[model samples]
Target chain A: MGLKEFCFKKSLWVFHLSAGSCNNCDIEILDLLTPRYDIERFGMKLVGSIRHADVLLVTGIVTNKTKSRVLEIYSQASKPVLVIAIGACPCTGGIFTSSYNFAGPLDKVIPVDAYIPGCPPKPEAMLAGVVKLLKSKNRE
Target chain B: MGKKTIVPIGPYHPLLEEPEFFKLYCDGEKVVDMEWETGYNHRGIEKICESKTFEQVFYVVERICGICSTSHPFAYANAVESIPGVEIPVRAKLIRSIVGELERVHSHLLWVGLAGHFLGYNTVFMWAWKYREPILDMFEIITGNRNSYAMFTIGGVRRDISEENADKLLKVLMDAKKKISLLTGAVMDDPVIHARLKGVAVLTAKDIHDFGAIGPTARASGVDIDIRRDDPYAAYEMVDWKVITAKEGDIFAKAEVRLMEMFESISIIKQCLELLKKENKGDIKVKVKEIPPGIGIGRAEAPRGEVFHFVKSDGSNSPVRHKIRAPSYNCITTFRRSCIGGTISDAAIATAAVDPCYCCTERMTQVYDIKTGKKMMNAAELIKLSQKKTEEIRAKGDKND
Candidate 1:
C-alpha cells in the first residue's frame, strides 16, 4: 500500500458537508466522537477545513443553493481522498429526496466510496460503515 | 485598533453544521455589527408537508430536526387530533409526555456537552455525552429508534409504553439523573467556567421581548412564557412543575437554565411513569372516522422552545397548507440582540446561546482581523482559547494543592 493510502485509512480526517439535510446525520457524525461510540480510537477526526481532510463525510441531500459550494469544497480537499456519504439523506435523499429544492443524491455530483443507509443511522452502524469503506479500499 | 472588519461565517463553513451566513463587523477585539444570511438550510418542508397524507406528514415534520424530532410530531398530532374532534386516551397522553420529556433531557444534555466543548471543557463534553447515551437508549427502548422517532401519529402515538418496560425506563431515568447532577455540579462549581461564561454576551429582558425569543433563550432573560403552561398540551398541564428561568440573560444563564431543566425533565418523566401506572391507562390510540374542513393550530414546548404547527385542511386527506415553526425560528433571531458589542471570542458562544438547530450550531465561525486583513479566529480557535483559560486555571489549582 502507498504512504498516502495507509495514512488515509489509519487516521481519516473527515470534513463533513450537509447539502440540505435535517441535521440528524450531522449529529450522528458528531456522536461518533463521544465516549459512547468512540470513533477517535480509529483515528477519525472532524477537521475545520476541507484542506486538512483525508475523507469527506457528506450528509444531507444536495440542494440547489449548496450544489456548487459542495463541489468547490470537494475540490479543496487534497488527493487520495475518500468520500463516504453518511445517512439516507445524502445516499438516497431519504424522505426529502423528492422535494423540489433537492439536486439529487451526492453520488451524482461527487464520487462516493460508500453509502450508510438509515433515517439517521445508529452510531454503531455509522462506525461500521466507515470501517467497511476503509476495508474495501485496502486493495486500492 | 480602529479599522472595522467583517468576520463572514458561512453559507457553508466548518464552525456550523447548517448553511446560514453571518457578517460580523468588528473593531479589533470586539464585535460592533453583524448581519445574517439564511435560506441555506431551508428545504421547503412546509411545502412538502402539504402534499403528503395527514398520516405521512407526522413522519415529514419529525425529520424537520433530528435533535427536536418529537416536538414537531407532538404539535402536529395535537393539531390533527383537534381537527377530527377526537380525544386521545389518557395512557397516550402520559406516554407522549414521557417521550417528549425524554427528548428534552437528551437534547439539553447534548447542548451542555456542546457548550462545554465550545468553552474548552472536553472533560465536561465527554462526561455529559456519556450520560446522554442512556437517554438515547431509553428512546430506543420506547420509540424503537433514536433521532427521528416515528412514534406519533394523527389521533395519538403509534407505540405504547407497556407495563414491562416501565421499570426499565424508571431505572434509566434514575441513572441519568445521577449522572446529570455530577455533570451540572462540575460545570457550576468550576471557577474557570464562571470566568469564561459569566456576564458574557448578556441579552437583557428587553432584548428578549423585542426579538420575540422563546424557550431557554427567552427564559434566560426572565421572560416567563412557557407554552406548556400557557397553552398546555399533552400531559404538561397535569404534571406539577415550574418553568426554569434565569434573570442574568448571559451565556451562563442559558447553560444554567438548561442544566436545571435536565433534572426537571427527569422528575417530570418519573411523575409520568407513576401516573401511567396509577391513573392514565388503557388504549393508546383512537381511530378517527372522518376529517372536517377547518384550520387547527397546535403548539408544544420543544426542548428549544414552542413548536407551533398550523394545519389548514379543506376536507382532504392531505392538508392545503401545513405550516410548522421550529423554536429556532424565533430563537436564532436573538443573535442580533446578543452578539453585538461582545469580544470575537464570545461571538461563537453568544450566537450558539440559543442552541440553534442548524443541528451542529458551533461548528463554523470566522473572524477577520481588519488591520492584518487575515482571518483572526474560526470557531475551533475560539474553543482553544476557552480551553486554554481552563487549563491555566487547573494548573493554578494543582499548584495550590
Candidate 2:
C-alpha cells in the first residue's frame, strides 16, 4: 500500500486505560462505541492490546500506586500516538484532587492531545473528541 | 508445590473501571489459584466521617461509588433516622423507592454493556449503553446529577416527583422497556455470545452458600436471597416485584438474571410513581437529630447486589466506625471457584460479567510502562494529545488543498 493510502485506510485502534476512576467515566467511554455515537464510524475501535493501538484513551486520576502500569501501556504503543483524557478526575483531579493518596494530573506523566471534560463527559463528547482526533491525523 | 504462572488483573484491568487487583496463578491457560487485593481506590471515606457532621456525612457517603452513590446515602439516612424514631412520610418512602429502582435500572444496563465489551460483543455493548442514556436522563431530570444523584436526606428524599415529572418518567420507562427487550434478545439469541458466556464460568447453588454470596450471583445460582424481599426496607414492601433467580450459575444465567431484573425494577418504579401521585406530601425530610449511641446495620439492594452499611454511633455528630460492604466483594470471592478451568480470556469476561466495581473495593494506583521505564499518560493529557494530533493533521490537509 502507498504511504498516504496506508495512513488513511488504516483505522485508528484505541486502547482504554483506567488509572483509577468510578465506573462512571469507564461506562461513558464504552458508550462512545455504542450505536448512539458509534465511534467505529470514524474508524475508532477499542483494542485489547496497547501494541496495536494508535490512540490511548486513559480515564481516572493517575495515583502513585498505578503509576507504573499506566506508563507501561503508553510506552508499548507505536509512534505518532494520540492520547485522550476522558473525565474531570483525570483532567484536573475532580473531587479527589487534594487527597493524600493521589499522585497528580494525567499530563504530569504523558503527552495529552484532548480533554473531554465532565464530572464524566457524555458519550457524544467522547466520540466527538475521537473523530476530531482521527480527522486531524488523516489530514496530516 | 509446582511453579505457577501468575497474572495480575486490575489496579488497571479492562474488566473494571476501578483499581482493585486479582492475582491468578494459571496452569497453562487455566487459572489455578486466585486471590484479590483491594485498597487502590479507597479514599479513606470512613476517615472523612470523623470531620463531617451527620448531615454532611450524608453527602460524603454518597460519593463512595458513583453507581451506588444514592444507595449509600439512603442506607446511612435509614440508620440515622431510626436512631431518632423519625417517621418518614409514606409519599416520601414511595419517592425513595422510585429513585432506588431507577438507579438499579441504569446500573444493570451499564453492567450489561461492560459484559458485552468483555465478551467481544461490541454491538451489544453499544446498544445497552445507548438504552441506558434514557434512564440516566430520567435521573438527571429528577435529581440533577447523572452519576451520583444526591436525592436522600436524613428522614426522606430531598426532591419530590411532580405529576409532570411522573408522566415524563412513565414515557421514559416505556421506551426503556422496548429497548431493553431488543438488547436482551440480542444477548440471548447470539450464538457468539452464548459460546463465550454459557457454561463458561459455572457456580453451583452450593458454591453460593459456601462463598456466602449475595445478590445476583447468589440468585443466579438458585440461592433465593434478596435483601429487599427478605428484609423489606423503604417502599420495597409496598411495591409489587419479584426477586428474579436462575438455576444455572454460569455467566449466561447471571446475564439472564440481570436482564430480567430490569423489568422488575421498571415495575417497582411504576408502582412507586403511581403511589406517589395518590399520597399527600407531609414532609420530605425529618429534622436532623442526634442518633442514639448504638450500632445499626442498614442493607439495601444496590444495582450490582446487596450493599450493607454498618454504622456505630456514639451519640455523637459522626459515626464512630463505618464499614461499607459492596456486593461485588462477595461476588469476587467466588471467582476462584469460577475461573479454575476457564481460559485467560474467558476469565476476563466472566469476572467482568460479575460487574465488579473495584473503585469501592480498592484505592487508585498509578500505572507506568514496565518496558520503557517511563510514566503513563492520564486521561486529560491523552485527550489533549489526541486533540493536538487531530489539529496538526487537519492543518496539513488544508495546506495541501
Candidate 1, position B12, lDDT: 68
Q: Write the per-residue lDDT of candidate 2 for residues B1-401, one digit (tens) a residue.
A: 56789998765554556667788888888788787777656565676665677777777677667777777777777766766667788877888888888988888888888787776776776778888888888888998877777788877788878889999999999989999998888889989887888888899988888888888888898889898898888999987889999998999999999999999999999888888777855566666656888877888888777887778888878888877777777877788788877888787877776777776665233445669946776878868988999999999999999
Residues A1-140 of candidate 2: C-alpha lDDT, one tens digit per residue? 44643553567788888776776777667666777667777677877778887778888778666676788878887866788899887798876765666778889988888888886687767777766866776666
The CAPRI class of candidate 2 is acceptable
| Candidate 1 local lDDT, residue B297 | 88
Cα displacement (Å) at residue A138, model 2:
12
Candidate 2 deviant stretches above 4 angstroms: A1-13, A51-55, A74-84, A107-116, A125-140, B1-16, B20-23, B189-196, B363-401
lDDT of 1 by residue, A3-106 (tens): 86677656778888887778888888888889978888877788989899898888888877678889998888888788888888889888887687788889
Error of 1 at B368 (Å): 24
The collision pairs in model 1 are B14-B363, B14-B364, B15-B363, B15-B364, B16-B363, B16-B364
Docking class of 1: acceptable
A128: Cα error in model 1, Å: 1.3
